[model samples]
Target: MKKSKRKLAAIAAGTVAAPLVAIIPATSAWAHGYVSAPMSRQAQCAAGVVQCGGVKYEPQSVEGPKGQRTCSGGSRFTELNDDSKGWKVTDVGQTMTVTWTFTARHRTTNYEYYVGGRKIADISGNNQQPPQTISHQVNFGGLSGHQKVLAIWNIADTGNAFYACIDVNVK
Candidate 1:
């Protein structure tokens, strides 16, 4: 009958759309993450050490394509990378540990720390899904005075990474 044919067509359409609806959320929401300890740029914003707009509300969202080498998360959150706002320098020794906080864990690729555009530390996450908190210990060597350290968190299965710029005074 005509009703049977219409029902079959509707079932086919629903089957096709189900995969798309499920894939959309599985990719986006689980992608958010950010560094917390040692006070990253977003952490400063969230803590009111610096003034920020949307990033203060959603620190985990300051992410962009891996290897970009800058913050702001690709313009939607440019305030994440803004330096004129002035951040409080965290007092750090020659070696310090930085931590990342995530609501949903993902298989991590690696963690990179850069000072003055030079890579000072690289830690492997080994495609392991860490706990809610991830930490990396970095050595700044003889570097002193005020400096900005850019930290990148690359995800294993995705080409995206979360970026955080930490201001520190190496002591």
Candidate 2:
């Protein structure tokens, strides 16, 4: 009878621990933000505008180490790095408003924008938590034609940053 009790206790412990084991990894990988306007690569994936992998389920989760240049933020969402992924290109003038939609607002260092591997704009975040929606007017300068814009949100308290890639046609 003691052996049966021990077996039942083990089963109960396993049942209780299984869910926590599953939930722990997911909690660590929870992400916060993404570019909403201009339809970032992950945003497109989430909207079903493009078929994608895991990123489609969480467009705002493309979080990785900062200062990396890839749209995926060098994370597992490598689909964002595919240049031929048939992303819709939005046409805009010399300047356009880039908007970010945040699910969880973290204290931010700054927002950076890059085009053709060149830093085009850097908007200071003042190391403060942002609103649910934030917008920046990014000037393309002399850049024109088809271009891929990389947007990065550097978190003040972490080494990770959220990344988004926007395909656009500058007129």
Tens-digit lDDT string for candidate 2 (1-171): 999999999999999999999999767545499999999999999999998999999998999999899999999999999998899999999998999999988889999999989999999999898999999999999889999999999998878999999999999
Superposed by TM-score, candidate 2 places the C-alpha of residue 156 at a distance from the truth, in angstroms, of 0.3
Per-candidate total of colliding backbone pairs:
0, 0
RMSD of each: 2.9, 3.7
Candidate 1: RMSD over Cα atoms? 2.9
Cα-based lDDT at residue 41, candidate 2: 95
**Superposed model 1: Cα runs more than 4 Å off:** 1-20, 23-25, 73-75
User: How high is each candidate's TM-score?
Assistant: 0.85, 0.84
Write the residue-wise lDDT of candidate 1 on 1-171 in tens digits: 999999999999999999999999877656667889888888889888888898888888877888878876474888776688888789999988999999667788988899988999999989988788977889998999888999888889788888888889999
